[model samples]
Every structure is written in C-alpha cells, then in structure tokens.
Target: MNLRVRVVHCACAGGRHWYADIDDADDPQPDDPFWFVDGCATQTQALETACGELLALSDRVVRGDWLPRVLEDA
Candidate 1:
C-alpha cells in the first residue's frame, strides 16, 4: 500500500499557487483525499505551506485520528 503525495502548482488570474493531493499507487479507486492548500503569493510559499499541511494530515491519518475527506464534487 504505497501512498504517494505530490505538490502541484499553477498560475491563475489571482496569481501563482500550489496544492497537494494523495494517491494510492496500488489501488485506483481508493477514497481520494481531495485536499488542497490555500493560495499564496508565490509558488515557493504555496509549496512550503502545502508540504506542512500534507505532513500534518498524513500524520493524523497514520495515527487513525482523522479520515481524509472525499470532496470530488466540492
């Protein structure tokens, strides 16, 4: 069960921003984390913030203290 997390970035009308998502390499239909980080002024800043958020979320998931939300329609 390999969980892969990645920081993705893009440019929008507001500015540059980044977000993170979790995926299971082994399972294709697993519950998607549907997690996203808030926008930042710079890509670097957004990525840094996203990394921290992802780490916290991942830790909680590991400890069975939290369940990732499924926000495909959100």
Candidate 2:
C-alpha cells in the first residue's frame, strides 16, 4: 500500500529542514520517525531533498524493501 505522506518545513538548533511523515491520524507524534533534509539553507533546497527521499522511498517500497526496521518497531 502506498501510504499518504506530508512534507513540512521545520527548524531546530541545527537549522531548517524539510520533514516528511506518514499522514496517519492514528499516530500524530511530532518527533516520530520521519524523513528529513537537515541543515538546508532554503525551503526550496529542503523540498528538493524531501522529493528525492520520497522517490527513493517509493522505489524501495515497490521493491518490497522497507527500511530502518527499528523505526518501524518504535
């Protein structure tokens, strides 16, 4: 199944990033395991990174290769 995902701009002490997460209401934890582009200087760059990550993730999913299994368990 292709899960719906959301990408948002976020910031931390390390700088800004594009953060992606499954858009599942059942699990709305802010710090939950997610995909992100860290230390990005601009939203545009972060977005680009997020898009690349989404493509890569979709590729893996299509190949039946779910990753970072420890995160799944958490």
Candidate 3:
C-alpha cells in the first residue's frame, strides 16, 4: 500500500490549528490505524508530528506488524 500523509490548517474563532491525516495514495479511506494529529498550534509542529507518525508506521509495516482495516475486519 502506498501511504501518504497530509497536513491541513484551520482558522476559526477559537484560533488557528493544524491537523494531519494518513491515507492511501491512490484510494483514500477511513480505516483502522488511520493515524491523525490535530490541534497543533503551528504548521511546522503538525508536519513534525505527522513525520514521526509516518516513520513509526513505516517501521511497523516493515516489521509486519501493521494491518489494514479491511484485512482486520475480514
């Protein structure tokens, strides 16, 4: 599976915040282990957090410890 991480920003009355989402590059979906990071005060912080999560996920995938939601459900 080709995984991609995306960072998004939002500005509201509460203030500015950032979020990150991890999904498949070709076909995205909401599934288990769908990593997310939110409420970051800065874009840099959100990107850093997303990078760390992506690295950890890659390690898990390499070690055969990661499972896609579809497989898990089956």
Candidate 4:
C-alpha cells in the first residue's frame, strides 16, 4: 500500500500546541517506515483499515488522562 502520514498542529485556546498525525495506511510512507511495508496489498484495503484505527485512537484522546491534566495545570 502507498500511504501518507502527516503531522498536524493542534492548538488550544491558551495558545498551547500539540502534535497530531493523520495517516493513511494505504498510501505509501512519506518517510523511512517503508522498510516495514512487507509488500502490502492494494491501497484501498489499507486505507479502510487505517481509518478504523484512527477512529479508535480519536476516541481515546477525547477521554483525557490524569497526567495530562497535571502537566498542563502546572
């Protein structure tokens, strides 16, 4: 698969910024991860799986974490 991964900057109201990556598994790796590709199948299949993974991850992020609050609060 030829997948693309991009890092997006997420900013908050207090001017805090965070790193967020949006990746498509079907797209070729934009960098060195190509070595792990393992000659994957068509892009369409890869993209579908990647989308599922991304959605699951987003759910976790919204749940928030205690350590995050401690650091940001300080």
Which candidate leads the pack in TM-score?
3
Deviating ranges (above 4 Å) for candidate 3 = 30-33, 68-74
Q: What digit string (tens of lDDT, one per residue) describes model 3 on residues 1-74?
A: 77788888988887889978776777644544357777999999999998898888788888988545434645
lDDT of each: 0.61, 0.58, 0.76, 0.39
Candidate 4 runs further than 4 Å off:
1-39, 65-74
After best superposition, candidate 2 residue 52: deviation in angstroms?
0.6
Candidate 2's residue-wise lDDT over 1-74, tens digit each? 44445667777776665655542235546455445445566667666666677677778778998555225666
- What is the per-residue lDDT of model 4 for residues 1-74, given as tens digits with 9 covering 90 to 100? 12343433334565533332343355454333221121224444444554555565556556752112212434
Enumerate residue pairs that collide in model 1: none
Superior by lDDT: candidate 1 or candidate 3: 3
Which is better, 1 or 2, measured by lDDT? 1
lDDT of 3: 0.76
User: In model 3, which residue pairs have backbone atoms overlapping below 3 Å?
Assistant: none
TM-score of 4: 0.37
Instruction: Report the C-alpha displacement of residue 54, candidate 3, in angstroms.
Output: 0.3
Clashes of 4: 6
